[model samples]
Target: MSEERETPERRRERLRQEELKRNPAGSIHGGGLPDLVGGMGWKFTGILILLLIVGFLIYSLFFR
Candidate 1:
């Protein structure tokens, strides 16, 4: 039917609109910083922090 046919761009826009309706905050603001932090979980975040600390210690000992 005519209603079922959509150009690819129009279909993508339609899907984007539906996503906005479902997650207005994320759709509008690119999910924000909290979304990124929450998605990483405490374990991964801790590991990242540990690696940064180790890297900083190595840099200070060797380069400075």
Candidate 2:
């Protein structure tokens, strides 16, 4: 029986997979904040910003 040889691209991909398995957070940044914002759809983001602006206006009118 002949052993299968891995191609260069396959070898590179395999090494990357092994590295990821060893260090799952090898490419993480900002500790999940980016993930949270990315998962929020544009519609939700728009509504959230609108609500914040309205709340700030109300607070300024009453407290300032």
Candidate 3:
């Protein structure tokens, strides 16, 4: 029996097709934006505190 060898392009295309099947929209690159505003209690509170600190700094610089 004779074996058939696949070309480099064909092998690459096959791998691309398999990857597309596994992940239709490709892979996510990094940790996405956190849901600080709408997440659980501590997360929301932490974000609020950070915003308050920033606001206080701005107020001190411009208003006071």
Task: Tell me each candidate's TM-score.
Answer: 0.46, 0.48, 0.36
Query: Residue by residue across 1-64, what tens digits does model 1's lDDT show?
Result: 2447886545655676788799787656485654555557679888988998999999999997
State how far residue 15 of model 1 sits from its true place (Å).
20
Q: Which ten residues in a row have the lowest lDDT in candidate 1?
A: 29-38
User: Candidate 3: misplaced stretches above 4 Å?
Assistant: 1-40
- 19 in model 2: Cα distance from truth in Å? 11
lDDT string, candidate 2, 2-58, tens digits: 226875545655666688689988756542544455556669878988998999999
lDDT for predicted candidate 2 compared with the true structure? 0.68
Model 1 error, position 3 (Å)? 34
Superior by lDDT: candidate 1 or candidate 2 = 1
Cα-based lDDT at residue 1, candidate 3: 18
lDDT of 3 by residue, 31-52 (tens): 2333233234566678888999
In order, how many clashes per candidate? 0, 0, 0
**Per-model lDDT:** 0.72, 0.68, 0.62
Q: Is candidate 2 or candidate 3 better by TM-score?
A: 2
